[model samples]
Target: MGTMVISGTVVLVVLGFGNHTWWLVAVAVLFLYMQYGRSGRVGRGASTSSPGGSGGGASGMTPGSYRAYRDRRDKQARWERRYRREHPMEARRQARERKS
Candidate 1:
């Protein structure tokens, strides 16, 4: 499949240089396909698999991105917990204000 795309693009590019400038249009479209097509399956990190999901339905999240997102959220939660624990008075004041 990779070879086919490269070969077709090369042919279109070569033809585009000649009188058939219209071939370049097809080449441009093909280039876009290659760009978007390859972007989704870049590396293992950009896997098609759903992360932390069931054996069904796609989560539409790459494992690497999900891991990074989860790590960031967990770190923030831990920091917030520590801050609240140390500042019980402030935490209670904020909680009370939020309830009203």
Candidate 2:
């Protein structure tokens, strides 16, 4: 894919020079930047998952990460409890349906 993009840019720049079309050259430069710039690097590097196959990046299972995850989970639980308190009939109906 990168090779094809580079080849296309080269062709575009050559055509731009041959035709004296500055916009073509500018477009070629833009394509090159899109193919090789920081955004492109990020897209390429995003798949570097840990060996654990969690697909959550390298620090996913660290102690600090676990603590953070636990804290987030607790906060979500508290929010859910508050929501249930605010909507007791909905919660009770859902719970009753689950029992059935």
Find the candidate with the highest TM-score and give its number: 1
- Please give the lDDT score at residue 28 for candidate 2: 59
- Candidate 1: regions farther than 4 A off: 1-64
Worst 10 residues of 1 by lDDT: 52-61
What is residue 58's positional error in candidate 1, in angstroms? 24
Query: Global lDDT of each model?
Result: 0.70, 0.66
- Model 1: per-residue Cα lDDT over 1-100, one tens digit each: 6667777777777877775775877677676766666665544445455575555333455656656588678999999999899999999999999999
lDDT of 1 at 17: 75
Compared with the true structure, the alpha-carbon lDDT of candidate 1 equals: 0.70
Clashes of each: 0, 0
What's the TM for model 2? 0.37
lDDT of 2 at 73: 90
